[model samples]
Target: MGRSKLDVGEIYMAESKIDARIYSEEEYLALDSDLDVKYEYFDGRVIAMAGAARKHVSITGQAVTALNNQLRDTPCEAGSSDLRVQLEGTRNYLYPDVVVWCEESRWADKADNTLLTPLVLIEVLSASTGHRDGSYKLEIYKQISGLMDYLIVSQNRVYIE
Candidate 1:
């Protein structure tokens, strides 16, 4: 079957879009090996979102820095957009703008590709990706058993979702 054509903001009658291709774990891992900015996937198809803008990055940095300072000396570690999470076997891996995970001692190395289960997750929203972050990504992160607080920080006037 062919994939449905849906524009970025066009809302489908259905909430979720099922892709025709289902990627294996190997394929997902290989995609991460590339040097360019990689993307996350659900099933087999890539999920598209624009690169972070200046305001977006600023907000992200502020949030991460604050969270990192707060988490210091605790078991939790705060990370900015430097970690990826593999959700189940659905090939859904996302790099949330800011994440805080409490299991720091488990990972042997700092950059050992750990999929930390954040008790706190933050995303500095961009207009192009706000909907996806609020909806699709929101749902995906909710599936994480350890998530306690999820914040979607707006680059526009001070707002958080």
Candidate 2:
């Protein structure tokens, strides 16, 4: 299957106005090989992810570092944005800012890139994505069976929820 092209203008437009093209799980996964950018799959809709700001990147790194430092010598492990987390039995796939999983980690497929079990999911909010991150993504992240906490960190200020 070939990867679908997305219009940058459409992606930055208002949520309701953005043109959404649905793709099957197979087609979505195939995009990994073709696209330079990362996307999040929600149900059958592929949402384009914007590049993180400098503050967003810094906060995410600090969060991951703090979590890893505290989790050292334990079963829990912290991962960065490159880790793709699947929403259990659903077709949804998201790349969180930081993810922490304890005990054995589960992979969605033989490739071992998609993580099925995440204990904690964190998102460092940006101006463009803060609203969706705090609301839409929060709701979806809550569906994970083993998810204990979902955090939304603001890059503009010292806020976390």
Clashes by residue pair, model 2: none
lDDT of each: 0.66, 0.78
- Distance (Å) between predicted and true CA of 46, model 2? 1.1
User: lDDT per residue, candidate 1, 1-161, as tens digits?
Assistant: 32222332133113334334556767766766665756666655654334778878888888878887887888777787767765553456777888777763233226657474557788877766676678767777777766789898888777887
The reply for model 2, stretches above 4 Å from the true place, is 1-19
Number of colliding residue pairs in model 2:
0
How much lDDT does candidate 1 score? 0.66
Which 10-residue window of candidate 2 scores lowest in summed lDDT? 2-11
How far out, in Å, is residue 33 in model 2? Answer: 3.7
